[model samples]
Target: MNPIRDIVILCNNRMAFPAIQTLHSLGRLHTIGLPAENEDVKAFCSVFAAKAGVNLIVMEKLKLNIHLQEIVRINTLKCVFTMTFPWKIPEEIIEKNPNVFYNFHYGLLPEMRGADPVFESIRKQKHESGISVHAIEKEIDKGKIILKKTLPLRTDFTHGMLCTHLSYLASYILPELFTLLHLNDKGVQQDETLAQYYKKPTITDVSIKWEHQNSKSIQALVNACNPWNKGAYTQWNGINIRVLEVSQIQTATEQAKTPGTVLEINENNGLIIQCYDNTLLRINTVYTDEGFMSGHKLLAFGLKNGEQFASI
Candidate 1:
């Protein structure tokens, strides 16, 4: 068997680009999947398309069943790899190479552990989000820190933008981290007290919570649900419309209208609707099953005043 030298990468294409580039720079590379693996193989007939490099092995699908054995074999040598959200890396792997394995996570570890981490961060409207490289342990995201970089959370940042920024950070940090690991440097331990846990989101979790939610809460909810999933929605005129953008009107002349009531519709001002706590939300965009439409045009299309939206 060939003695594996330097990194093996286990990540999707966009996120893996930096790792692949790093290997290319170091002249040692290996990968689990390639971009073309998803399509029908006959479509990629070119010689350039089908070739696999020594460092770039493309597996058709990732099977957890063989992962532990494969990782054990790889780690026995001096080889290192990059993994994000590993499905199955037995603790035996960690016990064998205690401080070698590392993965990048979007949120501060233990605080946001699970799928949809970017979404959870946006829901809380945190001022800062982080890209963390931690030692891979049996527990979820509860590993020792190798490197972590925090950045300001922009007001307009969606889940997509947040992921892009985090992935960029990972790409920048991983190679340097690998160099350190190669030198036998063990990273710092994480404070278990500071760690928190989050769960994978579900359809119910994405449903809009109309009652007991303020305008800011609603806005946070809207921002958190995009990229992979649509924003929390409600039925308007028997049609589902995902709330895309909303702005609170704090200087309204009076609070005479009930929450969810139509306050006004202007040719330029868009649709103004009452929020739960007497606040006004100027809805700018919404996604209907038929496609997206403006709240202003939705009302202009004859959706009546005082018509209720069904949101649990």
Candidate 2:
């Protein structure tokens, strides 16, 4: 029987929890959970770290070189794994110790690379998105592929749901990855021609374009921004409204109501708005200054049937 290799996991996201558990059970795990600026994130990390039996090394920034040096000085680090860690190690170190570092990306590489790929995929209405495990080099997500698993991108999947699914998938596949490493396998290189990168989603990206975007596009935006972002939003009667959940409804009413116009309100169906493509959008949930509420409550909160949602 082959001996288990000593591995270090560097992570900041909650999605790494399952994989962390798997690594801990393997009994050769050392973990570094980075400090988050958000108070909620800090609390979550504290809870998860306690359960995982990990003493997190909380740092303000992800200076990989400094962390690696300290880790090597203290322990015999044989391999490193990363998930949602914001920084990359220098190429010289990777060259000196080839195949020692690996990263799990949330998107199928060569197609979608960089931060917020899952959001980008949903925003673009992609039919499929996947996870990739690859060698970590100097260039971000341009490394050689070790193994990959593709999954369908369901139309109704929220950002949180997709992330949870991918994280669980990562936990399932990690053992196979370790076995491959034990056999000294070098991964396949990625094709640069097919590569595209996406930056993190901003407030502007999450804002709804009710006047210009089709119902399907708007629905996609709403699904893509949840749990991680402020969500696709609009203004209503001078109050900012974040649309947390929405569904597209096919309408046969060829009446050309202007986009953003409130077409109807029903006790069960909620606020129905006419979109740019003349299709109806049924909002299910929304966030206001007070808190989250169901769409039907918006009518009682001053949203009228004839009033329009402000594009800005």
lDDT of 2 by residue, 107-140 (tens): 8997999798889988989998888999998889
Indicate which candidate wins on TM-score: 2
Compared with the true structure, all predictions reach lDDT values of 0.64, 0.81
Residue pairs with clashing backbones, model 1: 29-55, 30-55, 110-196, 111-196
Tens digit of lDDT per residue, candidate 1, span 68-180? 44644654334445544335456766777665567777787667777657888888888888877777888767777777778798767777778778777776776677677
TM-scores for every candidate against the unseen true structure: 0.81, 0.91
Worst 10 residues of 2 by lDDT: 32-41
Best by lDDT: 2
Which ranges in model 1 have alpha carbons more than 4 Å from their true place? 1-5, 26-28, 33-62, 65-68, 71-86
